[model samples]
Target: MKATTRKIRDADATKARILAAAKSEFARVGLGGARVDEIAERAQANKRMIYHYFGGKEDLFKVVLEEAYLDIRNAEQALALDHLSPREALETLVRFTWQYYLDNPEFITLVNSANLHRGRHLEGSERLRVASRRFVEMVRDILERGAGEGTFRTGVDPVQLNITIAAIGYYYLTNRFTGAVMFERDYMSEDALEQRLAFNIDTVMRLVLA
Candidate 1:
């Protein structure tokens, strides 16, 4: 049993590495351009190993997409905001959401690639849905608490609120290149990022506050 468990652990580690490497490759180039050999090299595994583990590139892409959503949702849930005041909870979430995008550009790139493909790759990702459901539940709990305290608007849709929060951060990172060219300034500088995070928090508060 111990040997069996050890083998299982090793397999799981190899699979995780493959997923991590694939995320990088897919982020760098979309589904059409990512190469299995490169991903194998990056993971220090063989293409046959990747195939044995995940079937093929498209299936691997789907799992990569699932993992991306899984990561953000997992991080958000780990904040445990139920203990905080409604305003404080939301602010923490806003700051976290913005900072997460800044810290994880690969996430934005992966999502953009998925969108470019019209999300056909992610069409029936039950794992992604389950992860997202937890986040929506967390948001709903926050909204309910805020409503009870008379600090937030009643009947506000949690899904829409979450989307708005994500949109505020996502659009900024995803469009930074164009934004810099348009504004003639670096939108990703420390000062600029601070300003943007502040704006997102204030905007979300205004939208949610009673």
Candidate 2:
């Protein structure tokens, strides 16, 4: 039994390594540019083992994309926004979303790669759909609470609000280079980031607040 347990742990570790390597490769260069051999090398595993565990390059990419989405969703759930007051909850969510994008830029790249293929892999992910629904519900509840307290307008679509929250942060970071070139300033500077975060929170609050 001990030997069997050891074998399971080893298999899990190998799988985790492969996934970590693949995520980095895919995020760095996107799915079209990512290579299985390079991923194996980075993971310190044989190419055959990668295939044995994850089927092939495309399949592995799908798993990596799913995992990236799940990671953000799981983190958002952990924030427990429901426990906070409506205004505080909305502000906290906006701040969290911006920080999350900053901390996990790889997630943006992975999502871009998935979008390039028209979300072919994500279409089959029931887990993603369920998690997304839960997240939307959370936001909806927040909006309802705010409306009930007469601090926010009613009939705000949570989906659109969520999209706006993500887009404000995602677009800024994804285009930081061009923005810097065009604007002649460092969008990532300490002061610049703080200002951007403040602007994002204010934008979100104004959109929903009464």
Q: Provide the lowest-lDDT 10-residue window in model 1.
A: 125-134
- The digit string of per-residue lDDT tens for model 2 on 147-210 reads 9999999999999999999999999999999999999999999999999999999999999989
| Candidate no. 2 TM-score | 0.99
Give all candidates' CA lDDT scores: 0.93, 0.95
Q: Which pairs clash in the backbone of model 1? A: none
Task: Tell me, by lDDT, which candidate is best.
Answer: 2
Q: Quote the lDDT for 49 in model 2.
A: 91
Off by over 4 Å in 1: none
Task: Give the clashing pairs for model 2.
Answer: none
